[model samples]
Target: MKTVLITGATGFVGSHVLEAFMAQADPMLRVIAACRDRRKLLPGFAGEVREGDLRDADYRKIMVEGVDVLCNAVAWSSLWGHVADSRHLFLEPNLALIDAARAAGVRRFVNTSTTSAAAPEHSSDPQSEGIPRPLWPHLCNVVKIEAALRTAASADFQVINLRLGIFAGRRYALGVLPILVPRLKTHLVPWVAGGRTSLPIIDGRDIGAAFVCAVAAQGLADYEGFNIVGPEVPRVRDVITYLHDDYGLPKPHFSVPFAVAYPFAWLMEKLDPIVPWEPLVTRSIVHLMEEVGVDNAKAERLLGYRPAYAWRAAIHAQMQEMAVRQTRAMSMAMPIV
Candidate 1:
């Protein structure tokens, strides 16, 4: 049996990755899920669950056991934190995990990266550039990890870095969708400099499937980095409008200029350092209004990868999940009058 170790096995993408392996029902597969909190390890897995911090000195002792494959899915994805703290959150833990995995003689290593690592300098294609792009704080950490993994790549262990775009599915962060829906339905949202920025999106299900493909492939086979994203690109404003039409919500109302809305977004960020409960018009998201699409043809030709779900279908699924949650929330809360 081949043993596969998954880090961040309890997070949004990690959860799906775990489920994908379970659904396969492969007898030769033994999954070892590594998570920081034992309490977050949900039921229904036939494999072993190890609880430990990835940055710990003893991580190798705890996780790098008889493993053939190691998935680097752990990350501190918050928008705000001290730079030093952020670096520690991403750099140290990831670096330690990579060292441990290599030490364990893991035959294959998969590192999940973000497309934000590469910034677009200029682009004629509106879908490609000329927008305010948010400087992803964790991007440096990803690059550092990538560099370390590349240096360690030898005949002993093969490494593949999967640079993923904005992922959507049931467990998504629900960051931009709230702003999109309200704007599309009620037409009451302000435009972030005309909202022309194109954001690349990939369904989490497709990302999960890609991991399975990676495992099946077992080696890089002449490929190193792959951008895991959808074929078609959509602008931020259009995404909201599409959701409005799909959910039968009120059409969006774009009134104020994006620059005008920037202060409110700043205020929201100041008030809520954590992810905003609603989408705030910010410079980073404003850049998303410009093109942030990826070139995913590499994954297609090499891994035979394809997006399992279309962007519209992904949105519809999210809408359904949101409705269910809202209904449950309303049911639980009695009228305060």
Candidate 2:
């Protein structure tokens, strides 16, 4: 049996990936879930579980042993920290994992990345190639990670990088939506450039399918990258309006031009040390909103990846799940008569 070691198996994205692999019913595949908290793992997951920080050398050493494929879905970031902090928090540890995987003779390594790695400033055609801009911390790190993946690829090993679109699902806890939803309810979020820009969003379940495809893809080059996105490309306005209409929340009534918003975001970031929570907006977020639609054709052709959910349907599902959770919470809080 081939052993696949999945790091960050407890996170939103990682959990979905784990679910996909387990559901495959591949008798020849043995999955090993490596995460800090095993309790957070998906229910009824009958797989090998290893618990520890990936940064710990001993932990990584043990996790990579006898592993054929290493699927990395781990991510680390702070709402109010220097962009350079990403080097220590993300890049360093992941690079270490690559080394460990190589030393342990892992046959394949799959990395989960963001489509924003190829923002407009970096590439006119993100599907073919992307030049990472150094302005944003996340983009810069993705560039470095891609470079590392290329360098690590050899005759014996293969690398697959899935550049994923903005994640949309009930399990999604990070990114723009989670930050903006509550603010929109209070009428605190603003429309950037009248919210006309296209926002590429993919359901987490589809992302999981993409990871499984990456693992099973055959005749692939030593190094390959694919842009993973949803079936429909929705405008920023449509997303905000959907939230407002579906949940009866206040929509953004005002607009902020990029020029004005970027400076304000920079200033807020500067004041991050004293700020209690993340700023309402940031330059990176603005840049992401400005991106054009992502092309998933390459993924479809290469990995046979056909997205199963439309943006509207995915958002509706998330809203319904959120409502159900809220109702359950309220019901539990009420005193039993």
lDDT of each: 0.65, 0.78
TM, every model: 0.78, 0.89
Give the candidate number with the greatest lDDT. 2
Cα deviation of 119 in candidate 2 (Å)?
A: 0.3
Estimate the overall C-alpha local distance difference test score of candidate 2. Answer: 0.78
Residue 275 of model 1: what lDDT? 58
Write down the RMSD of all candidates, one decimal each: 6.3, 5.3
Model 2 weakest lDDT span, ten residues long: 328-337
Displacement of the residue 83 alpha carbon in candidate 1, Å? 2.8
TM-score of 2: 0.89
Please, what's the RMSD in Å of model 2?
Answer: 5.3
Residues 51-106, candidate 2, lDDT per residue (tens digit)? Answer: 89887899989989999998898876433345656676678889999999999999
After aligning candidate 2 to the native by TM-score, how far in Å is the CA of 4 from where it should be?
Answer: 1.4
Instruction: Please give the clash total of every predicted structure, in order.
Output: 14, 0
